[model samples]
Target: MELRIGNKFRLGRKIGSGAFGEIYLGTDVQSNEDVAIKFESVKTVHPQLAYESRIYRVLQSGNGIPNMKWYGKFSLKTVLMLADQMINRLEFIHSKSFLHRDIKPDNFLMSKAGKSDFGLARKYRDSSSYRHIPYRENKSLTGTPAYASLNTHLGIEQSRRDDVESLGYILMYFLKGSLPWKGLKAGNKKQKYDKISEKKVSTSIETLCEGHPIEFATYIHYCRSLRFDDKPDYAYLKRLFRDLFIREGFQFDFVFDWTVLKLPAITMPKPSTLCKCTLLILSTF
Candidate 1:
């Protein structure tokens, strides 16, 4: 079945698809502006749908995240129904008292302009990316293996940390151009996970992200720290990333505080500086 693509939204092309749904570029019928459309599906749920729904619904969206727009829930095609499932996941989880268990880059998208690099784009906006996932889409596990959290891996109940791990993975993938597990392949889940958990083995991540500018570079660093703990939580990750941001970012051009901050300044040579210079000359003589 085909979704109605209106003149208001001209579907330019198919950009990407997730496990739950497909994302499409649509234009505003009245204003003729670009918008994204996600198709979801609804099926009689007996199992995994609960997890997917729990994560989506429970996920607390603040900051710049786009609030979900739930359309009329209806049953649709299962073929390419990944998108359909995700909407159901989003709705169900939020209804329950849980945040999104999985928050990866694949789960979100941005306007074409915001999709560009931070330097190229007017601004870097991630939290606001649109999620055009399908209804009742999530089935398998509630999370992706690559970006899933330690709690998720250990088969713990869903929590905010799952989203944190996924978000960290997305941030790294976008800024650095690859997941920590981008290239390596494994015969089994255990082997693949060992590679991610021991990030020191992933040399490609360092090499590729090496020369990026400070802002993006800092983002990658934050991502590294996030993936370390097995049960990484968003609040913990947020605090860690926040401290790192203050210390490393351009927005933190702090002047050296001589006493409290305990930093030295070489503004003008003081009497001490002159005496030191003199001592050096005398010692050499």
Candidate 2:
């Protein structure tokens, strides 16, 4: 069956699905350009689609972040560029008085165009008001258990520091291919999450980064050191990645690991063939 969204894009085969909804490979009918259309039923339980869409709109113009193009997503080498882009994205989010509660490798979709996904994001408050949000213990767990910070698991209100801690785990996961808590067994989901949280808090940074880059451990340490109300030094965190990049003699070109993989033939329409009508409609969508 032929499916269309926002009256301008034709949805093709299903590419993936998550808690929010199903994502389909789609094409801008007029331009014949590829895009990914995510559809969530209006009654979807989480209702993160609208929030995620809004976040994408806010971040579309940010540096190093990806455009809306769904085709040509790429991975990075050494994850330095990835770190830099994510830090920029987070900085922009913070500047807007929002906190990205859910930060994981899955949430960070990389491509030629940058990072894209923000379903679990929420506005902390007005950027003009620098007041700290009080920690609440009654809130339920909100992010991926494996990568979530100890504070998140404890139900303390998440702040910028929690996001930074989550980023550290994600970066380490990218470099190490897996985290130490990947295979913990438990009687139930709650127990499982509790065990994961326990592991995250109990494990030392050195143990987490053992056999991996020392910088990875250091990054985790720095993030975990921040106070609940501390404003993170985003520049310093980014410099850690930059120093790693320099030490490894890697360049900031877009070439990445996925570029080296054997990808299927993707026929992208040339600029000359793209219809302005399609671009206009896509922008609205």
Candidate 3:
């Protein structure tokens, strides 16, 4: 039987699943538009969708963030453009006093430049006083290990720096097509996770960004230099890529490598000073 939601959406087949629950492709009855609806099992110990839904509500007006209904490519130009968008999104999230604990390629929807999956989203500041959260240690690792910061592996409390660092990893991953610790071997899940952490800690930025532009290393270095409570130099970091983009003579055309290959692609418009309401849920579950 076809399942219907809210008397407005008709659920289609299940498209994917994750730690929380299943995601179904559905259609809005009123508009006949497809929407990705996430469902969490009521019996689950850690219910996330409801919390994520709240975060979406707070973040709705932010640029590059996925709208409530919503929910990539491979190239330097692609990476640079993505870097700008991702940083912009992170800045907005931070400005709203929340941390997008999970920062990875899988969490981002390519065409929309939307960051989805806020199951691990956290508030880093006090709602009343606007005070930054105190630093702590020995917190369990959150987010994908491959793209996690070394501080995260060390069980330290994560902050904006960690998110920015994870973005650095993501950019390098895009350029290199895979991270160094992607397929580490171990006896079990815990062991494998430890190996990933070890690899991340041991891999120097120089070695990691070797053969890539110096700006990549600069980005990683800057991220690592930030203290837990330190505000990231978002403008400086963005300028690094924007300058590189200009130096490399890449156009702001949003023509990614995949687009050149004639693969399925979405043409993103040139960003304006004001945030645009360009929400679409194209993320995999």
Top candidate, metric TM-score: 3
How many residue pairs collide in each prediction?
38, 5, 2
Q: Estimate, for each residue in 1-285, the C-alpha lDDT of model 3 and write its tens digit.
A: 122332344545557866565566766655777777564443346766657767877877677765565322244666777788778888888888999988875566544345666889999998788899999998999988988899999999999999999999977776664567875779998999899998888889999988778999999999999999998989999999999989876786656443443434554323321111111232222
For each candidate, C-alpha RMSD in Å? 23.8, 13.4, 13.3
CA displacement after TM-score superposition, residue 102 of candidate 2 (Å): 0.7
The candidate, 1 or 3, that scores higher on TM-score is 3
Once fitted onto the true fold, the runs of candidate 2 whose alpha carbons sit more than 4 angstroms away are 1-76, 111-115, 261-285
lDDT of each: 0.35, 0.63, 0.71
Question: What's model 1's lDDT at 6?
Answer: 15
Give stretches of model 3 more than 4 Å off. Answer: 1-73, 261-285
Question: Candidate 1, residue 81: CA error in Å?
Answer: 30
Select the stronger candidate by lDDT from 1 and 3: 3
- Candidate 3: worst-modelled 10 consecutive residues by lDDT: 271-280
Top lDDT hit: 3
Candidate 2: worst 10 consecutive residues by lDDT? 273-282
